[model samples]
Target: MGLIITFLAAAFLIAGVVRGSFVNKRANEELPFPTPVSQEVEGSTDDRDVPYYDDDKEEDEVIETITPFIPTPTVSDSQTSDSSATNAYIYPNSTVLSTTANSIELSSTSDPGDITNWYKKLFEEKHFKARSFAQTNTNGHVLNKLAGAGGSLDLEVEIEKKPNEKITVIKVTY
Candidate 1:
């Protein structure tokens, strides 16, 4: 048993020496590196120290001033109501989809009932009478206000929330 162990150890040491010799030979070889190629310009001379520039003549000096631009601010609901002739009021935080002379469509992330309630309060504050209809996913209101010279202005508002949706659609007609 001792003789067999001695032979196995000698065989392993010889195999390691052979493998290390091959690795060392590979490591000593030089690696190839890339070199850059110089490009010559069409009008340049043989001198390499001076640079080439096309513009040789000096021109007159010109100074220009730059001004910062400012954008116009958007009108809020309260500010818009006082200036509009129809006294139309849009819900805050709602995105307007379309608008015409007599109608407006809007989209909101609020519930249908909340939008309906807001319109009801707005009508009451304007001293107008409104009739409301409500269902599980929809609400509607018809509002009336006295116009000048014995004429009446009618406004219709509808709010709908589709099933399993977080968005509500609003349609207002005047």
Candidate 2:
């Protein structure tokens, strides 16, 4: 009687495990999956919700279509003209990144003295009010007073030579 009861219990446990796994297979197969809507689809929630983008547009056309990352450079209140730019000599490798109505910022690989020589002429030849002398072996600035329509335009050129840097940062600002 004990052997019969044990055998019946094992058979019932095996049958329950098999029935649970197989029961869901037919139900899952009968139901269809919810497909995702494509971006290219027209007149649905997917089409109206997505932002517009065209792949076939030309290079220039696409550039024109998109907004600029940076705002366009505007002339500041203390702006100077390009007259000083033409007068001053620049190194061949120097890059003039920006030029405003009143100021110019550039970087050069040439000697700082060479740049100072050009600014010196603005005082001597053109009669711009300039500093008497520059200190030796330091970041020296040549300040010149340029008489503007408003008043005296403070033109200061900083000759900064950093250690281990090949390029000298020269900023001529008024």
Candidate 3:
């Protein structure tokens, strides 16, 4: 048994040495000539990939911000009754942030499980056709279509929660 163990140890050492050369990556080599001029350099205009650019030829940029088709329910004079209750956000102490590109970010103190169920019920009640709703751990993906903007909008609602924290964040990408 001692002889067999000694032989096995010797075989493993040789195998490891042989594997090292095969798995090791090549070392970085210095360039034979200077680096290409197109590469980014400090205080160089080469970053734009053009030798020269005329300020007079620049075009004006116009950005059109999109608005969400579905607005959150609010108490109004016309909706003073039961309809206001349906439009109001159900999660207490939650904030929804609206971005310039029609994206919505929501943060709440509720758990991911509760948020998922609330959204599922909300979308279903609003007659939004759900294409996919998947949940794993604290991550969720919800794809639904509103009454409008189905032709051009690639809308997505994503939910993520960090471990060892009570905050769950949701993002709506439109």
- Which candidate leads the pack in TM-score? 1
lDDT of 2 at 128: 58
lDDT of 3 by residue, 1-174 (tens): 999999999999999988876656323323233223332356875566533334444335543579879987787774343433422433455686544334567788776777767666655655555345766652333222222123333345666776766777776555
Better of 1 and 3 by lDDT: 1
In model 2, the Cα lDDT at residue 79 comes to: 62
> Which parts of model 1 are misplaced by more than 4 Å?
1-87, 138-151
* Sliding window of 10 residues with minimal summed lDDT for model 3: 141-150
Report the C-alpha displacement of residue 104, candidate 1, in angstroms.
0.4
Tell me the spans in candidate 2 whose CA falls farther than 4 Å from its real position: 1-93, 130-132, 136-152
What lDDT does the true structure give each of the candidates?
A: 0.64, 0.59, 0.56
Tens digit per residue, CA lDDT, model 2, 46-157: 4455545554443432222566699789988546455645436333447887776666778888776766666566546545554554634534432322221213544566
Q: After best superposition, candidate 3 residue 161: deviation in angstroms? A: 0.5
TM-score order of candidates, top first: 1, 2, 3
